[model samples]
Target: MRKSRYIAKEVLSLFAILVIAPCFAAAQGSEQSDKEVKQMIQTQFERMYEKGIQNLSDRIVLTGGVKPFAVVSDTGDNVKAIRIRQAEEMPPEIALEVLRRSLIALVKKGKIGATAIFYTADNPNKKSNADKVLVVEMEHIFGPTLAQLVPFTIKNGKASYGEQVVVDMEKQIFNIKVDEESAE
Candidate 1:
């Protein structure tokens, strides 16, 4: 009887370890995955910002398609008759960078003001593709403006947070809408 009880105890200990070990490993893996995704997003944002600041022509090309509410140049503000020619070809990544810079510029110039925004991952909508795209919805500090920046979904591993924006991988576009409510 004593021998049987000892054997049963050993078996139960082994079973518990087998069951708990996988859960522990999975938790560690989940944490690591989150870290990697965050790192990728930060790197991509930094790279895009750097590239945009380096070349103004890139910005022009990117925002050329969108309607500009306010224009700021080295010479002066509100340069009338500014036209952006559509290039024969534009890479998706370059377009995305340009759009981002133009919006930042507008914000800096006080053309658009927002307190907070909501952002979500639109494309892939799966755990695997969670890191693929981020949709940002901007909440205006005041009323919305007529100036609509081109809705761009970030591909090539870019992340963003805002409101009412759909990041569609299949379409390769970020669909954005403005909300008056602050989503801080």
Candidate 2:
């Protein structure tokens, strides 16, 4: 047989689906066969970073907090938000758990790609002059499992967002093992 070749993205997606998804999908979204969606996520995260964080910050300041929500990219320009049946009384951690599981299911089925999940948070770990924070977790099959914490304080009906704190994360979601695949 001629030597086999695998583009980096293809290999990454394969590993993301077979190995990474099962372990990390709980923390983030998983792989999709759609390269366009994966590429969009890889390239558009900076834009997503700006818009998603700011939108949630503004809303959370007004409503006290926002529910667990997500945005999924279907293609380069085709993006949609995910709305879940959230209980008003649901604990914040539990609510985010529900959303994470739901998004992972969608990822396994390849219905979407490059998910960004946001939740309202109160972390005792950091005191940034704010009790409430916006937590955003982004996952791309072709890139890293990334997260950010945007802390903010509200006064006089306006929200003052603090410097965004980067959360250290893993990147094997797209890691691939070509020989391992053939062996299996």
Candidate 3:
């Protein structure tokens, strides 16, 4: 009876090593792959964020106020511009809302790596650093959503921009969703 019990214990140990081990290893591998994907998306978000800021700055320098617009990067890293047209009767806030909706729609239907939306506004708080700020909202489909308030001044069609202040934003683009099934 003691020998039979010992054999049973050996079988259970073998079961754990051959079956449970791979399951645990695969879960670990899935987690690692998720991290890698998030990191790659983060890089794309950063690149597109910078591009959005530059585009806004250039427009402000030339036009004093900016038309809200978007920039998107695809999975292949191809970048493109999307201009949001505002109605003559529309306020800046209304224009911004229109742009936001357009950006969200694009993210949902496109094979997007990252996307950013840009608009200019008077700094909401007087205690804040600058009187004027360009609002840049950015997102990565599998990563994070961020809002950057970029301080800047324009003179002689030249722009001088300060370091941007970043804040965590609610995801409206792709809901920052990644397919866990695929990860598994």
Candidate 1 CA-lDDT value: 0.30
The 10-residue segment of model 3 with minimum total lDDT is: 1-10
Q: Give the top-scoring candidate (TM-score).
A: 3
For all candidates in order, the CA lDDT equals 0.30, 0.59, 0.63
Name the best candidate (by lDDT).
3
C-alpha root-mean-square deviation, each candidate: 23.9, 12.7, 16.8
Q: What pairs collide in candidate 2?
A: none
Better of 1 and 3 by lDDT: 3
The TM-score obtained by model 3 is 0.68
Ranking by TM-score: 3, 2, 1
lDDT of 2 by residue, 18-125 (tens): 454456645555454344345545545544444455456567767877888777664333456676766446876787777766766665555555677777778555
* Number of residue pairs clashing in candidate 1, backbone atoms closer than 3 angstroms, sequence gap of 3 or more or interchain: 9
Steric clash count of candidate 2: 0
In what order do the candidates fall by lDDT, top score first?
A: 3, 2, 1
Worst 10 residues of 1 by lDDT: 1-10
lDDT by residue (115-166, candidate 3, tens digit) is 7877788877677656678887887655578888877667667766667689
